[model samples]
Target: MAIANESRQEEQNMREEHHGAGRYWLIWVLLLVLTAVTVVTGRIHIPTWGLVLALVVATTKGTLVLLYFMHLIDHRGANRLVFAVSILFVVLMLAIPLVDLGTRYRGATPPGSTVSDMQAIDIGADAMEGRFGGGLRKEGKTGEQSGSPRQ
Candidate 1:
């Protein structure tokens, strides 16, 4: 039928739009150059904008892979819309946890130290003080002497 033939023609046109071996080789070489840039950025510490530059390079590489290798360029608009939405969700997922961690209190507890170490550091009445700074009024409940805090 004419409809079947038209569909085949459209499919052929889509195939033609796909890049040839030369185009792929060019993209591959560009990707290699970007990779070299990434390695150089990793070696030298730029402090402020180092992470930003690395992210930009990574995003560029990802975009190239998606557009060419994934064949998203010749795909439907809906496919691109779906991809964009997914990316937005991924960003939101990473950003929400970062916000939570950023707003939290820093160094509330001693890093990698035990309770015995804390007691050794500050003994007697100071050791009896709780995490929130309230000293124990009555002790010996957990099998210590009639007076004094837990061991």
Candidate 2:
């Protein structure tokens, strides 16, 4: 059992050490070229094809970033599970805002209790008239001052 464990450890170490430098550099160059291509491709018109191509290219970029930068592909199940849950939470957050926006015209509260009803506009013909005397004033039949209620 001890000898088998040693062999397994040695094999793991060897696998970790054998990454190819030239292929890694080539991968970096490919990523850069693909990014440039995505940018340029956005400028041209392709009608129905453009949307599919854009999503495909975006997914490709996401995959590369996930595998290399996020290290998800190389990571074990727990790390990937964490990523999945995080993505799910973000989707949930986005969905809530969309629901709120969609329900704007739908009645949530009593109709007459909203903001506009709280402050009804002053219907007095005199825009400059104040109910109480600052500049323009209004008088009752007994000639008493009524304060500006229009504002």
| Top candidate (lDDT) | 1
Q: In candidate 1, residue 72 scores what lDDT?
A: 73
lDDT of 2: 0.63
Query: Would you list the clashing residue pairs of candidate 1?
Result: none
Give me the runs in candidate 1 sitting further than 4 Å from their true place: 1-12, 16-18, 94-151
Q: Write the per-residue lDDT of candidate 2 for residues 88-136, one digit (tens) a residue.
A: 7766775687567546653443344442224445546554464343455
Question: Predicted candidate 2: what Cα RMSD to the true structure?
Answer: 10.2
Against the true structure, candidate 2 reaches a TM-score of 0.41
Listing every candidate in turn, what is its Cα RMSD in Å to the true structure after a full C-alpha superposition? 9.3, 10.2
lDDT of residue 150 for candidate 2: 48
Stretch of 10 with least lDDT, candidate 2: 109-118
Error of 2 at 68 (Å): 1.9
